[model samples]
Target: MNHALKERIIAQSKQLGIDKIGFTDASSFEHLKDSLEEQKAAGHTTGFEHPVIEERLYPEKIFDQPQSIISIALAYPTKIKEKPDIVRGERRGSFARASWGVDYHNVLRDRMNKLMAFIKEIAEDEAALTFKPMVDTGELIDVAVAQRAGLGFIGKNGLLITEEFGSYVYLGEIITNIPFEPDTPIENQCGTCTKCIDACPTGALLGDGRMNAQLCLSYQTQTRGMMPEAFRPKIRTVIYGCDICQQVCPFNKGKDAHFHAEMEPDPEVVTPLLKPLLTISNKEFKHKFGYLAGSWRGKKPIQRNAIIALGNARQKSALPDLLKVIEEDPRPDIRATAVWSVGEIVGSKGNPELEAFFNTLLTTTEAPEIIDEINKVIKKLH
Candidate 1:
C-alpha cells in the first residue's frame, strides 16, 4: 500500500476511538514462540492450553491469503477518585479496572466493527480485497501483534504498556489481504522495575513477562468447582481479577484515570459488603452483576470469592449471611466456602452453628469432597 494511504487508514482508526494504530506484515510470531514454549513447560498454560494456539502462533498458518496485520489499541479509562483516608483501611473488594465497566470484549468488538467498515470503504476505493477483524476472542497473540505494530512494549506484569496509556488499554486487530508498510516495534521500557513482581499477592508474574496462570488470583477466582488449598490465603480481598501489578506501575502515575461513563463501576460492586453478597438470592445476584464480566463465571465462584474475602477481613457482620449460605446454598462449593467463612468469623463462638450445620449436611449430602470440607471446618471450629 502507498505510505500516504496507510497513514490515512491509521488516522481513521484513531478517529474511531482506537488510541493507537499501526501495521505489520502478517508473519509467524517467532519472537514470542520461545517464551510461549517456556510458559507451557513451566505449567503456566493451565486451562488456557490448546493446540489451536500452537498453530495460530505461526502467522503464515493463520492467514493463508493475508498480506498484513493492522493492530489497534483502545484505552480503557482507569481514573477513579482516590479513596478517602477513613475508608482506606477497610477491606477492599478488588476488580481489575479493565473489568470495572461493561465487558471490554464487547466494547472493543464494537469499535473494531466500525474500523472494519472504514477499511472496507478504503479497500473498495483502492483494491478489491477483504479484511477480517479479531479481538481478544480470537486465537491471535494480541499483545505480540500490538508490540510488532509499534503500539507499545510488553511490561513485566505480562500486560501491554504504552508510554501514554501504560497497561490500561484493550487491543484488537484486523488481518487484511492488502499489504501495508510495517512499523518498527518499540524496545522494552521496564528497566529495574520489579514493583509488579514484588506487589503480586500470588507471585503469578515471572520476571520475564510470562505469567504462571495456575497461581494467578484472577484465574483461580474465575475457575469453576473447587480451588486448591495453597491459593486460598493468597487471594486476599480480590473478588474478581487482581490489579496489584498494574496499580504499582510507575507508567500509570499522573495519567487520566476516569473511566468512560459506560464503564463506571456499579456502587453495589465496588468494595461490596460481604454480608449482603452471601445471602443474595439468585435473582438478586443476576440483577446486581448481570452485565459484568465477572458474572460469566456465575454465582458459585463469586459467592465463594466473597466468602474468602470475608474470611480474610474477619468481618463479624457477615456471620448471618455465611450461616444462610451454609444452610441453604445448593452448590456444594458455595456451601463449603460458607462453612470456611463461618469458621473464620465465629471461631470459638462457632460451636453451636457449626455443629448444627455439620449434622444437617452429614444427613443430607453424599459428595465426599463437600462432606470432607464441611467436616474439616467443623473440626477447626471445635
Candidate 2:
C-alpha cells in the first residue's frame, strides 16, 4: 500500500520541475562509510562537505524511524544561450556551469518543500510520518543515495551520471519515515574511459570515483588564501569554479538541459571582466554575484582567482589595473597576486616610470608579507 505513494511522488516531482526522482531504503550506507573513512584518513574531503562521518553515513540519525530516502536530480544547462565574446583587451573569467544559474540550493529547496507538503497531505491519515530535506550542503551523502535509488551511477570524475541527463544534475534528497519501495542501483556505465582523469589539470580525480580534494582546482578556487604556486597556471581563466573534468566527460557530451528558467545564466555575471573584479566593492559584488553559488565564499577568493587569471592571460592591457591593485588594494593576498600579475604581464620591462614606482615601494613598504611578495615578483621580472 505504501509503495503506491511512490507513484504519486513521481507525478508530483514532475509537476514541480524536478528532472528526475528515485527512492531507496533508509539503511546505513555501509560501503560509503568505509570509503568516507578512507577519504578522511587520506585527507580527501573538500571541507565544504559535512564533517561528521557518522551523520553522513547514517540516515536514521537525521529522522526518527527513517524508512526511505527520496533522491532528486535537477539537470542544469551546459551551453549558454548567446554567450558574450571574450575578445582581447577585454578578457573575462569563467564560472563553472554549476555556478551559472541562480543558486541551486534555493531552486532545489523550493522543489523539495513542495514535495514535502504534498507527501504530508497524502499521508495525513496514516501513521506518524516525518521527513528531512537536504541539498548539497546537507549531512547525508547525496550521490550515494541517488546511486542506490538508481537515478545514476557515480562516475570516475566524482559526479553522478544519469542516463537521460548525463552528469549535469544538481542532487537533493528527502529522508522520510514513510516506507517506499527501493529502486535498483544503476549499472556502472563508464567503460575503459579515462577522459575526465586524463583531462584533469591537477590530476585530482583518482581512478574509480576517488579524488584528492586538496589538489582539485574547483576546491582551490573557493579558498581565500593564495593558491598553491604549482596550480596557479593550471587555474587558467576560471575565477570561481572549474569544469575541466566535467567538460571532458563523455556522458556530459551533447547534454544541455534548460529545464528551468531560474537555472539560466546571465552571461555578464558568469563571465565578468577579470580586471573589474579586482576593484568591485563588497556591496556591488554581492548585488551582482550573490545570487550565484560561486559567491558563497565572498569576494576574497574570487578576487584572488581573478588576479591569477590575469597573470595567466599575461594581458599587457591589464598591467595598469594590476599595478593599481598592487599599490592600493587593502588585502595583502590580493596585492600579492597583483604583483604576480604585473610580473607576468611585463617581464623585465625597461619602462622608467613603473620601474621607479616599484623600487620606491620595495624600499618603503612596511609589511614583511607585501615586501616579500614584491621582491618575489621582481625576481620573476628579471
Candidate 3:
C-alpha cells in the first residue's frame, strides 16, 4: 500500500548498484508444491534443496507476518578478461561463471544488508520494520521470487533471464511485513527456442522451465561421493560448476556485465592447473579457492572433478599425477575416480608402468572397491 516507500526503495537500489529490483506479495507459492513433489517422487532432486517442502512454498511459515518480498538481481561477468596460461602438460580446469570472483552469496548478502539497513533508516518506525534477508541457502526459491517480482522471466534452462543481463545474474530476496505495491510479473520470453534444453549436456532441462536436478552436471560436480561414470565425461574440465545451459541460451550471447568488481574472476584461480589439484593440501586449497562460491563443497569434489577432466581430455601427461593419487590419496572416492581417469588416459595402449603400478597397488590397497577399480584398469589397459 505504501507507493512512496516502494519508489524510494527502487531509487535507492540504483544507488546501491543493484542490477534489478522488484517487489511481490508474500503469498504461498502453492502452485509449485505439486511439481516439487513430482520431481521428488521421480527421484530427480539433487538432495541439496530445503528438506521441508512447505517452508519453501510458504514464506510466512518461516517469517512472521510477511506481507511482501523484495527481490534483487546483480549481474555477474560471463567471460574472464585474462585467460590462464595452459601449456601442454599444464592443462587447466574451469569453474563456471557463477563461481567467478568472490562467492556470490557473500556479494549478494553485502548488497542486501545495505538495502535492509537503508529500509530501516527511512521507515516510519525503524523498530517496527520486520524483515528477513535470504541468499541462495534460503528456503524460498530465488528464481521464483525474482520472477514474481518482475526482475526477469524464467528461461527454459530454469534460470532468470532479464532483458539486460540475460541469465548472467545472481538473485537474492528479503521477506518483510511492509505492504509495498507489487510489480507485474514478466511473461516467459522463451517461446520456441529450445536451445538451452537442447544444449543440456545431461538432458537435465525438461523443456518446461524445470530441471531434473539429479541429472544436472552442476549438481553432480557438487556431490561429495564418487561421480557416476555416465556423468564424468559430460562434466568435461569444469571442476566446480557447469555453465552449458546458460552459455547456450540465445539471450546470453555476448552478455557479460561488470557491475560489481568483486564478482570479476581471477583467471588463475577460476581456471586452475589440473595436476596440482591432485595433491593440493587442504590449507593450499583454502588459500587458493576458499573465497569462490564453488569451493563450498571443499577440495574433495573439485579434486575428483579435476581428475575426471584430465581423463576426459585424455591428458596423457597427467598419468603420473593420476597414478600418484591412486598411490597416496586418503579418500577412497578420490583414489577410485583417479583410477577410472587413469584408465581413460592410458586406454588400450600398453603401459608397462601402469601395469607394474596396478600390480603393486593390488597388494597394498586395503579398500576392496579401490582394489577392484585398479584391477579393472589393469585388465583394460594391459
Please write out the lDDT profile of model 1 over residues 175-292, one tens digit for every residue.
Answer: 8888899999987899998999999888888898888988888889888777776777677777888777888999988666453555666654655655566667789888877777
User: Which is the better candidate, 1 or 2, if ranked by lDDT?
Assistant: 2
Q: Compared to the true structure, candidate 1 yields what TM-score?
A: 0.89
* Cα-based lDDT for every prediction: 0.76, 0.87, 0.91
For residue 327, what is the lDDT in candidate 3? Answer: 77
For every candidate in turn, the CA RMSD to the true structure comes to 3.0, 1.6, 1.3
Error of 3 at 322 (Å): 1.8
What is the TM-score of each predicted model, taking all chains together?
A: 0.89, 0.96, 0.97
Runs of candidate 1 exceeding 4 Å displacement: 81-92, 124-127, 281-283, 348-364
Name the better of 2 and 3 by lDDT. 3
Q: Which model, 2 or 3, shows the larger TM-score? A: 3
Q: What would the per-residue lDDT of candidate 3 be over residues 1-382, giving only the tens digit for each residue?
A: 9899889999999999898999999999999999989999999888888899999999989999999999999999988888777676678899999999999899899999999999998989889889899987989999999999999999998899999999999999999999988999998999999988888888899999888998999999999978988899898898988889888888999898988889989999999988889888999999999999999999889989999999999998998788788877788888999999989887888889778878888878788678877888888985
